[model samples]
Target: MIQVEGLTKRYGERTAINKLTFHADKGEIVGFLGPNGAGKTTTMRILTGYMPPSEGKASVAGFDLLTQSLEVRKRVGYLPENVPLYPEMSVVQYLDFMAELRQVPNRNERVDEVMEVVHIADRAESFVSNLSKGLRQRVGLAQALLHKPEVLILDEPMEGLDPQQQIEVKRLLREVGAAQTVMLSTHILAHAQELCDRVIIINGGQIVAEDTPDRLSAQIAGGRRLQLEVDGDGDGLLAELRALPGLSSVRVVADGRFEIETAPGPDVRPLIASTVVGGGWKLLELRRERLSLEEIFIQLTREEAEAAAAAETGAPLAEGQAPGSDSAAG
Candidate 1:
C-alpha cells in the first residue's frame, strides 16, 4: 500500500535519505529497522505526507503523495515517535478534535470506540499533560485509529511502555495488522523479530537488507553456526569436531559451550551427536545458532560503510576500524 522510488531528501549539502526505494504490501507488517540518524524518520515523514521529498516519487494507498497528498493522508494513520499531543486538552477532547478533522461520521461514537480499543477509555477526562508516558502513547494510538485508515505508519510504538504494557500494545498491533498495512519503525530488533512479517533494514540512509527474518539469517550469515555442549573433555571434543569434514572453526564461549561454524548445507547435528556418544561423552546441548538480528544489523552497516569507503577511496576500511568511526586525526 506504500511505494517509494529514488526518494531523496537533502538539507543544504547533507542528505538525510538518498534514493530510498521500497514498498509495503497491503495487510503486511514491515519493520523499518535503523540506528539513529540513519534516515528512518526522514523516510517516514515523507511517506506520511508530513514533508515533501527533494526528488523522486511516492504513493500511499495508491494516491500520489505529492499531487494527491490530501487523499493519501485520509487513508493513512500516523503515530510519530514523539506524538503531537495538546497538553491542555483532555484525552477525549484531543481525540474528538482529531476525529472531526478527519470528517469521521458519528465522530463522538467513533472516538469512544477507538479510545476503548487502545484501552484509554478510563482516561477520557484526564488531561493529556496528566497522563503517563505509556498512557499518552495509547492516547496517540487512539487518535491514529480514530479514522480507521487503511495504512498505519508507527514510529517507536513500543516506547515508554512497561513489559506488560508492551505485550498489550503488541497484541493490539497484531490485531490491527490483520486488516491494515503496517509500517513499523524502530531500532529494536527484538520487537521487529516478534511483530514483523518482514524487516527492511536501513543504514546510512540506504536499504541494506530486506527479507523475512529467517531468510535474512540464512542469506546474510552465509552459513549456519552450532552451539554445542558435551559433559566431557572439552578439548577432546573440540579437537575431534575440528577434524570432521565440512566443519569450520570451533571456539569455546561462555559456560563452556562450543560455537562451531559450517557452510550452509545439510544437517550435521546427528554426526556431532554420534561422535560425542561414541566417545562416552554426554551431549548436553546441540542446536543451530544463527546470527542474532542485532549482529546482522551491525554486519550490514559495516558492509555499507565499506562499500561507501571503497567508492570514495578505492581502498577497504582500515582493519579494526568500525563503520562510522573517526580517523586518528579526525
Candidate 2:
C-alpha cells in the first residue's frame, strides 16, 4: 500500500535520505532497520505527507504523496518518534478530540475500541501527562488508529518500554498487521527480525539490504560462526584458534566462551573439536550457528559505510567484494 521511488530528502548540502525506493504491500509488515540519523524518520515523514522530499515521488494507499497529500494523510496512521500529546487532556478526551478532527463515525465507541486495541483503556480517565512513555505511545497509537487508516507508520515504537511493555506492543502490532499495512522504523535488529515480514536495512541515508529475515540472514552471513563454551578459561585459546587454517577470526567472548568464524565451504567442526581436545581443554559446548540478525545488520551497514568512504576517496570496490570492501575478504 506504499510505493516510493528514488525518494531523496536533503537538508541543505546534507542528504538525510538518498534515493530510497521500496514498497510495503497490503497485509504486510515492513520494517526500516537502521541506526540513528539513518534517515528513517525523514523517510516516514515524507511518506506521511508531514514533509516534502527534495526529489523523487511516493504514494500511499494509491494516493500520490505529493499531489494528493491530504488523501495520503487520510489513509496513513502515523506515530512519530515524539508523539504530540496534550498533557492537560485525559486519554479519552485526547482521543475524542482526534476522532472529531477525523470526523470518525461512532467517534466515542471507536475511541474506546482503539484504546482497547492498544490496551490503554484502563488509563482512559488518566491525564496524558500522568502516563508513562509506554502508555503515551499507546495513546498516540490509539489516536492514529482512531479512524482505522489503511497504513500504520510507527517510528521507534518500542524505544523506552520494559520487556513486558515491549511484548504487549509487539503483540498488538502483530494483530494489527493481520489486516493493515504496518511499517515501522527501528535501530533494534532483533525487534525487526521478530516483527517484520520483510526488512529493509538503511544506512548513510541509503538502502543497504532488503529482504525477508531468513533470506537476508542466509545471504549476508558471509561466513558461519561456531560458538564454543569451554569449561575453563579460553583466553589463551583465542590466539591458537585465530591462527587455525580455514578460519576467518576467533575471539574470546567471555572467560570461558569463544566464537569462531569460518568461511563458508567445508565443515570444520571435526578439526576444531580435535584441536580443542588436543589442547587438553574441556569443550563444554561446540556448535555451528547461523549469523544472527544483529550481526547481519552490522555487516551490511559497515559495508555501506566503507563503500561510501571509498567512493569519496576516488577508489572503486574490487570485483566480488562487498559494496565498500577494500578487498574480497573485506
Where's the lowest-lDDT run of ten residues in candidate 2? 321-330
Quote model 1's TM-score.
0.86
How many Å off is the CA of 213 in candidate 2? 1.8
- Give the candidate number with the greatest TM-score: 1
For candidate 1, the per-residue lDDT at 40 reads 89
Give one digit per residue, the lDDT tens place, for model 1 in 212-252: 88666655554457778777556577788888876878888
List the candidate 1 regions with Cα displacement exceeding 4 Å.
Answer: 222-224, 243-248, 253-257, 263-285, 312-330
Which pairs of residues collide in model 1?
Answer: none
TM-score (C-alpha, index-matched) for candidate 2: 0.82
Worst 10 residues of 1 by lDDT: 321-330
lDDT of 2 by residue, 1-330 (tens): 999999999999999998999999999999999999999999999988999999998999999988999998888999999788999999999999999988899988899899889889898999999999889988988888888889999999998889999999899899889999999999998999999999998887888788898767756553467788878786578777777788988877889898788776665667778888889888888865656789888777777678776775432212232222111210
lDDT of candidate 1 vs native?
0.84
